[model samples]
Target: MSAAHRPGLRVNAALIIPESELSWRFSRSSGPGGQGVNTADSRVELVWDVANSAILPTLQRERLFERLGGRLVDGVLTIAASEHRAQLRNRDAARERLATLVADALRPPAPPRRATKVSRGAKERRLTAKKQRTDVKRLRRPPTD
Candidate 1:
């Protein structure tokens, strides 16, 4: 759906951040706009208040806090987009980026890894390879009696 008619930004099946919670800032982009670059505000910054959002579940909020700690400042998350020359495209890019980031943060953590030891056969093969390499190097040396 278009931004104008859309109710909120869909992060995942369980989460939809309302438009009211999103804020936008725009400035002239630094690259590739030719003459329009000077006059247009093509760079977009999309900010969301994750800590204060009404739509976030308790667990999701905690997960976001933990996963995005470096990115967030004072409980707010900001995403910037400037690759596009048009303001609308930059805005869309920012929104998509925010949604993806929030969805990843809300995902469950991976299961712990299980450690294992090398098999006896594998150890024997490795030893055999080392012996072969040593014999080859010894053969390359000149005979000394």
Candidate 2:
């Protein structure tokens, strides 16, 4: 994703993050990619401080914490991208991931399910099946007489 194509995310009614809230750091990536990966800083680390962000609302903050609490540390939201060979592409990918995370956090959770009781007909059917199995077992046994 290009800088021009970056989405405008509104955390609050007045505050909006238009590619500004994101901070990217490029570092030499480990693992495969031959010599290119060893020489170039292809790993992109994207950091967004959710706790100090003025854009997000209280509800959004709470939701973000609940959804991304594992990735978050010291009030900062961190995401890394190193799949691509190019640093810019990796950086863009990381930013996209962060945007996706935030979008998911903004959504409301489903309502809690209510406790349900089994129907009487269903219970009767279960008992009937058990009795039929018991009768079959009794028939298989020898008479006491």
- The alpha-carbon deviation from the true structure for residue 2 of candidate 1, after best TM-score superposition, in angstroms, is 2.2
CA lDDT of every candidate = 0.92, 0.81
Local accuracy of candidate 1 as per-residue lDDT tens digits, 35-118:
999999999999999889998878888999999999999999999999999889888999999989988888899999999999
Residue 137 CA displacement from its true place in model 2, Å: 4.7
TM-score per candidate? 0.90, 0.77
Model 2 C-alpha lDDT per residue in residues 30-75, reported as the tens digit of each score: 8889999879999999888898887777988898888888988988
Q: Which candidate is the best by lDDT?
A: 1
Spell out the clash pairs found in candidate 2: none
Clashing pairs in 1: none
Which model scores highest in TM-score? Answer: 1
